[model samples]
Target chain A: MAPEERLIAVGVSHHTAPLEVRERLAVAADSIPTLLTRLRDDGFSNETVLLSTCNRVELYSVPGVRGDANGLARWLAETGGVMGRDVESTIYRLHDQAALHHIFRVVSSLDSVVLGEPEIVGQFKKAYRLSQESNAAGPVMHRVMDRALAVAKKVRTETNIAREAVSVGRAGVELARQVLGSLEGRSALLIGAGDHGKVVARSLLGYGLTEIVVANRTFGNAVNLAQQFKGSAIPLHEVERYFPRVDVVICSTGAGKILIDRDQLAGAVSKRRGRSLVMIDLAVPRNIDPGVNDLGGVYRFDLDDLAQIAGRGKEAREVAAEEAERIVESESERYWRQIMNEVVTQRIGTIVQTADAVRVAELERLRSTLDGLEPDQVAAVDAMTRAIVKKLLHQPLHQVRTWAREGEIESVESLFTAFGTRKEDDV
Target chain B: MGSVLTIASIVTILVPVRARRLAQKNNAPGGIAAHRNWEFVAVGLILLGLLLMGMQSDVLPMLTVQGGLRTLALFVAIGWLVLRRKEKMAAAGMILLPMAAVLLVSSLLEPPHAVATSVGSPFFTTHVALVFLGLGGFALSFALSTLFLIQRRRLKRKQFEDIGQLPSMETLDLLNFRTQCLGFAALTAGVAMGVFLLTQSASGRGLGDITVWGTCAVWFWYAAGLHARVVLGWRGRTAAVFGVVGFGSLGAVLTVVTVVFGGWHGS
Candidate 1:
């Protein structure tokens, strides 16, 4: 064999770290190639994938360096510009089967902040593509990712986990409906032209929204999206100006800075005159400021709050997730077995090839001695030697295969060494 | 042989009871298989009855009380298949098929009188066929309404047990209305033919008889329900409630006419 290689994963996710730490660690899309190259150049791993999303930043690798978990953690902390900043406490390292199980869980959305959400699969696919393009993802990663994706698809199809809407937009709309009773005749203001903003607007329309106002940094983009929903468009700066006329506000802008602060929203709340104002901030850095929630009659929710609303229907999904986890476990076990079998088969093939080389050399050395004898005598001697070799090798080969299958790799390796067939010898 | 077939038909119809219980337990494949088998066997038994009656003579004696109920059950089975093609109506079938079995078996328990031979008039045969067929249609409507109400309650509570397989409330309402319309037309013609035949045949059972009055009351109630549904645009829960009440009143009238008045046509 090719020396025992294993699947490994190291990561920091929503469960282990706060949003402040996650935001700092989140890798930009363009920097993935450089990070992957660094992972290879620095001897972190032979096959690596850096999965950076809003809720998590995970690195999956194969043929991982032994006893280098702490080193890898320090490298990741340094890359995220948080070295010596206590980021080490939040990092986790997994190896072998635990690493495989972790990847399955992540792909199936069982490890997601919103349990059973579908966005993580697409995010993981993007990370896979990045690693493939950078040539950091080798054959092992290719197999692991392909199998992980298949497991994710099977979980989605065979379970009810993906049936419910677990998006921030859907949850925010549900929360608004609960507070306001009905969405009929309700007006909503979409404060960004982003996809998530459109999702919330669509959810509002599904609830019987009468009107929608779209506002974006680019006024033309706002108008383009507004036409689809049959809503009006406004410039980004003029968003708060129309908030008083709308019942709900959804914000998901690309700007990393907070767009709606308390001072700006306080005036808007005053304009509403004690009417309930439901504002949802779906951006990573939060487009709407937290301080806006303190104002009277203004209900502000960030991604965390949306996660809570999404959990309302989680009991049903929990049952499905359990079933999905079982599928993952079974599939992963099968894949691991297949990998071990392939390794054992390749080792046996090498041993057989070396034995053939030794038999050919011994027969050539005896060719001159048989020249003086009759052709029939030479043929008989050749047949006797072949039969002796076959009979002698059969039981030992069978025992080695059985040992390999029984997970006694050490015994099989020692057997190959004892036979002196582990190396290439011409004689 | 006829009694044996009737019992077999009843047994076949009761198969849906087991099928429905299996469905509720989430064994959908097993439930579906049992339901399909039940449909085949029940329809076969009813057809066998018709065939045996025809085997006895050129003019069959299938207008008797037991034979008429068997014929009604056959029509209901056909209706079930037709509506199933249009929508998911397993819940309606689950309730309606077992009731058809009970009624068919009950009809068989009546004393073996030669009522079919006594009422040998062609008009009497037509009246019995039409009325029982109408009753079959109304029973289907009643079953659909019951399912509609159940589904509505489940939807209101957001508890979706077997909701994926059951028909929607709207589909059930539409089907209930259509079946009621068909039943009303059939009942009207049957009652009209009976009255005309009574006048011409010199049967002493006239308008004064409680059976005739009860039949008239049943006709008028259905006519009103149909009229309210089409003309007043009454639908959903109102139409569902109306269907249940209309079918119940007609059933009560049927019991009184058969038991108390001793069945005006032949008994």
Candidate 2:
């Protein structure tokens, strides 16, 4: 069988698994090449691509002779150092058309934690690139991934699903704009220079924030983050000192206790003299004191609040999302059909070539008897034999295509074998 | 004909208000564009009504109460249109449009009075026009301040879902400050012209009259508010509060002088 005919996908995503399961299965970018090589060398798949993002850890592969969907799932579980039984329920396995549809949906971000997010496309491209570097993905994966990317591009251009701020950091930025008006001359203080805080700071800068002040538990991290924006950094302990000057304060630290209390924010508000302040708390276990929200001239939003804002964006893009789903559905169906047709054509060509070889061998044996005939008569005999061979092969070729279309692949293989066409005969 | 146009303008303004509410409900951008387009149509209707009133009147429209109310609506509409050009000031229309509608309705309610032929001097005419223009400024400031307070409340309460399309509190405060300054200057000049005419005439109207005291009181209130904003750095909630109160007092004094005490300035 061709590698494309044995396509399979096994994964645990945000929808099917909890965050803990996904985290366990998630592979780092630097580790992806090793994983891809292992997948191919260990005989799990002939061609494979590993897509490991924060929201999902998916493996798209075409299994080899010793490989199957269950084997791929077990391999994934072994890589994560988890028991197969522990993740068996969460691991979703798809095959053939269903697998292709899932790939299209994932590349288009329709299967993301946040619908229509743009980050998934880049992550998918990076995964495909790493697969190529590892020499694990061959022509089959290249064709599938390239077509997936084209579908994603079409969905992005033809729909408005990605037009609004659906991600948490971006939604927080939108809420900040609502409270603080224009951010052109405004400044933001980012507490704990972590990835989430960096993302929020980048969004704020994108919306025209002039300055960013970073404060981290580690002073070097703070300095590094601040230098990226040409801003300043302060010690984590001195965050309250800069509160009165900045228009927004984003708290994304990992500290388990309250960082800023009501009294500290009250003092800041007093110094601000009625200038509005927006506080976004993106940390878990509640970094900033929730009571600080009661202070006048101060607006505070935590993760749940940001999620609600993001939900509003999702609601706004519902119409666009419907359009995108239709595009994915139609594109996947068309692409799958084309792939099936190519397989059918290859099988039919093999059958025809075997029959023609038989005819040529028989005609060679009759060359002695044809030596007495004229050149024109000899040509007629050759043409009549070729016509006879074509007429004899027509019904079998038609039946092969019909069986392929009806998904009776076993019957098609039996017919090909009965006609003396072997797998090794494919050129 | 003027009343018809005014009513049509009020109805037109309601279209954008409804569109705004629908937009907020559905979280759609198309509704907002529709709201903005309809708002323009509403303002155009107000302008057309004002032009019709101008062409029909023999003397200046500022000579009577109905004309004064119509003039107030026109000025408020014009002020709203001008501010709408600079920013997303659509939320201000929630208050400003209803205020204009009330002015128009009030004009329709008032009994028609003869135009004062003896008060035909250009000085008196310019004074009345400036006073109404100043009141127009106050009305716009009041609308902006009201929106500022609503937005402030939404923020303080952390009711982000209800914020809708209101401008930032800083933008509202700044626009209120500018409008207050313009209103104060125009009222000051108009009051000066009233004082000059009072001194030259034998009409017996002076500072002792309740209307004169009332007008002066309105002037002093806005003057103090503007002074606090500029000199003491009083802004945001404070400036918005002052705007609301100043306009309230001005409305009260106008009602008492016109409705209870009859006309002022020896009318």
Candidate 3:
């Protein structure tokens, strides 16, 4: 009989648990090998793979899934320091078909916090690589995961999933417009001249924002930037000086200290007679302090924090998201059906082999009894015997095929395993 | 028997491989005409339809085979127009092929001028053949000229878009002049054979006749355009416009003459 295959996906993720749980479960980049080994030792075979991201962590294994899932759930709870009740409830367990569906969803960006975000695909590929390096991926998981990535790619290319959404920079500008309510005669202050900052500045310029004042660390550089876009330029030192005059402060600079702190911003707001200020900090270290987010008449968002206002993208991308989901479901079903096909094929091979052996023995016995036959007669008998075998096998093979297509292979495979004399071989 | 003869005819036309090479090296990469992928299918259908003729029930099979050929041509043009993305020429080809197909079908149904009288009819048949072949050649030149004209306009205006995908101008001009020369040869042959057929008939043959003179006039018009293209260094819009006038004259003579005669070859 053919070998059995099982797929298990057990890990903590945002959908499965809180971010705290997922953070603990995340396999660090450097520690992937050690984690893979630990999981393998605890009994995940060569088919184990770890997919860890900031928002989710998922482990996929093949060939004995539900049983393997229990082992993974226990291991994760102990290692990631989640309580048993939390592990039991939050650690989402999926076996065989469900594991495939989950992988498809993750790759399609449906499971991401921001729907239709293009980042998850690259991240998933990197995770698959780490699993490969750790020798934790086998044929079944490999095929399923490869198809998952393929489905995600097809969705992005064939549908408008990626382009329909607003970019983070544009979203920031939209938020600014929302906060200011109008850009009529309001001067927007653009700090730094980076790619993101320039994009937001241009988007602001597109929305009837002509009185934009630009300030950078390099004053002449700021003037070069300003003249190119027909906006006023300012000296970097006079950035805070103009803060009182501008209605909106869009800071995206590389200052080590807090460039737009609450105290300095408060003075600017007081001077401007409590006029609203929208600060879009698209920097890693954060150009504006997070404390300013709650300040009166102020709306601030850092690079990571941009996604919340990026909901405009969600509204735009909803149309494409439905199509992407349909693609994922179809591809996921195809993968599982292929898996079931393998199950049927394995059993069919064993049955055909056994039947052929028995028939060949009986034919040999019959040939000896008909030894008086001429050479051509013997050859004809041989051809007839082979044809008889073919006739006998065709109906059963066709039934097996029909069973495989309809997903009745699991029951039929168990029957074959019971009938076959060799239960010891690897499948 | 007819299939064998048609096969022989095609082999005779194609034996040098020079004519096929000449056709390809001229056409650009926008359409099936350029690729010549239908070399096997087009020739194969001709052989098949010819083979079917007279080897079976005559009129039904003849009309059926001809109908199939028309359908094949239409399908080929559509595939070229759509999958090959050569919409303009396909539209133009569509406009011309049905005319020849309709005349051929009607001739087939009516015994093509009575077989008992078909002896002298071959000359007139050659005339009909010349008209159709001339029309085909003119269509080819027109397609090339239209492309060249578009490219020329785009160049003059410094507007690169909407120019038909075609060979470079030098290539297109050469193709236009060459195809005009071929059609001129065929039409000249038609006019000569047509005069021969008129004289072979029992009726008094008049060479200086008006309609006969009209066909003669078309011959000179094409010959003059050919001279203008080759010697006068006329090119681009001027050459293309002249070719259009030449083809138009030939078309007018064929239509008006055929209508007067009731049809080409009196069939």
Candidate 4:
């Protein structure tokens, strides 16, 4: 690799692409090894890691001799069975420090759809692990990934970016807690076993809810969902029978009509004898009547309400994310400088080694002349020659380091060439 | 010195509110930590103010309205510090701190009243101390109950702007319950003491005085609320409402006795 060559990242994320375009280029975990090998074998990159998550599909790479970002972008589009022109608008290419900043933000979840969701970090680690196992990651990729992980850990510990719940399901759980106080001995009655309801139910279960009664239109589906939570499944008609028993009722069915009305909820409230009940209606057509909110001791929230709560959480995380962004920016600059310094050190070492080889060859040629001197005088002569070489190279090496510090990579490279060092010597 | 320290405490407590607002605007770091550190400073200032008031007073400070207000501010500040340690009751500070500042200012403005005629009696001193302490507890409970109502309203209406700053409704309800219970217990004891003192005294004062009856009415109101909570399992909105009204009546009774009767304790 050229001394000036730096890390680059290219692909589409939720920020740049719509779901349709992203799904077209999404690589599955089982196909990661194959795609990585193809990228290397086809000269798309010398080293690369493909991160494919629901929100983003990215390629982090040290560009190969034959490939630049344009070539990599085209290859990415083709690999996903799409034409280059189809995704050209959605693709983003970042190089050097920008690439480093992007990776750090991504690993820290600063770029997530839900501000500080944690799944992205695990996805990044898995992508990196796959790259390593496939022998696709080189020393530069390894160093970048390692530093990115450390930056992520620092951001998480130093800031409160990930402390709030910004997702809809988690926000529902938060609202439930706000209403019911503690979920330790509380029970929930899930009216539908659909995906959205399942997500909310899972969050409730995670928060120490003791019992979950799943009531679905299909009895077997309800049974399956309830069995997963170690709770009972009740028939759809029996939802009211179990309603007064649970602290929370989650409604997410496809029912077009109101399943529970204000009067029925009032009756249940009377039965509960003053304990507060939370009614979370996650259904699209509105499973629970909106009028139920007017009844005392009943806290009712729909999808919009949960979204509002989640939006507030997003606002809180945004404040914390401002601090996390600063950390990522500073760390990226520091790591970039460290990488440059390593390159400078390697170049300096090569020049000194070349000079030393010449010194040794000349000393062997003058062996007979040195034999006339005593052992102590010969040792002194060797030491004096070594010191002379070091003094002669010191000024130029110092200038190289200065150029490196000033980010004058081309100047540093020219200095290496002026010293009769070849490109292959860098490797 | 005590008045100055109390003023300083109020200023210190407002620092967190300013920091929080600035943080929301500028996306700045350290607001949370600043809030926490300034709360400690405020607590320290209030503590010093209380100590100075105690040292400067000739007799027990609770004998005068000025001294009583200062003592109430001290109790509320101390109670806030303790409750905030365990829950996100920072929103309570928005109500409690300003209330304390008002009490302190009122204390500064009011002239020191003559010491109670029964000041020499240990029983009178104890009764006055208990009443003021009970008032302090009720003051804290009032703030908590108000926050509970606001939070409950926000949750019920789903208007969640800046709602994250308040503790969960459950936490607020629980804290409100505890403070109301504390206030109720103190007031019960203090009322019992007043009854005993009235019976033993030859000053012609009796339990039938309007102020005494008002105090008893306030006591009965709290007694019913607490009974419903413990025995009838009342909680949340009902309990918070009871606390709010209980404190309001207690405040009215004190106001009537001070302004209309022209003396403390129906003199």
Report, for all candidates in order, the number of backbone clashes: 0, 0, 2, 0
Off by over 4 Å in 3: A1-5, A63-67, A166-307, A361-392, A421-427, B1-267
Using lDDT as the yardstick, the better of models 2 and 3 is: 2
The candidate scoring highest on DockQ is: 4
Taken over the whole model, the C-alpha lDDT of each candidate is: 0.75, 0.80, 0.62, 0.81
TM-score of chain A of each: 0.80, 0.73, 0.64, 0.68
How many residue-pair clashes does candidate 4 contain?
0
Candidates sorted on lDDT, descending: 4, 2, 1, 3
Q: Model 2, range B1-267, lDDT digits (tens) per residue?
A: 878887888787677767777876797746667566666777787778767776887666666777777788878877887887766687787677778778877777775453343366889888888888899999999998998889878776667775756777777888999999888899999999888878877766685677779989999999999887677667888889999999999989877766877655424
Model 1 lDDT, residue A385, Cα = 76
Of the true interface contacts, each candidate retains a share of 0.00, 0.50, 0.00, 0.70
Among all windows of 10 consecutive residues in model 4 chain A, the one with the lowest summed lDDT is A418-427
Residue B184 miss distance in model 4 (angstroms): 0.3
Off by over 4 Å in 2: A1-165, A316-427, B1-59, B114-118, B161-164
- Per-residue error (Å), model 1, residue A222: 5.2
Quote the positional error of residue A236 for candidate 1 in Å.
Answer: 4.8
Q: By the TM-score metric, which is better: model 2 or model 4?
A: 2
Give candidate 4's error at residue A386 in angstroms.
80
Best by TM-score: 2
Query: DockQ for model 4?
Result: 0.41
State the lDDT of candidate 1 residue by residue for B115-232, as single tens digits.
5232667787788778877887898899988887676554333344444466645457778888998888888888998888777765566656776677788788888877876776
Worst 10 residues of 1 chain B by lDDT: B155-164
Candidate 4: which docking quality band? acceptable
CAPRI verdict on model 3?
incorrect
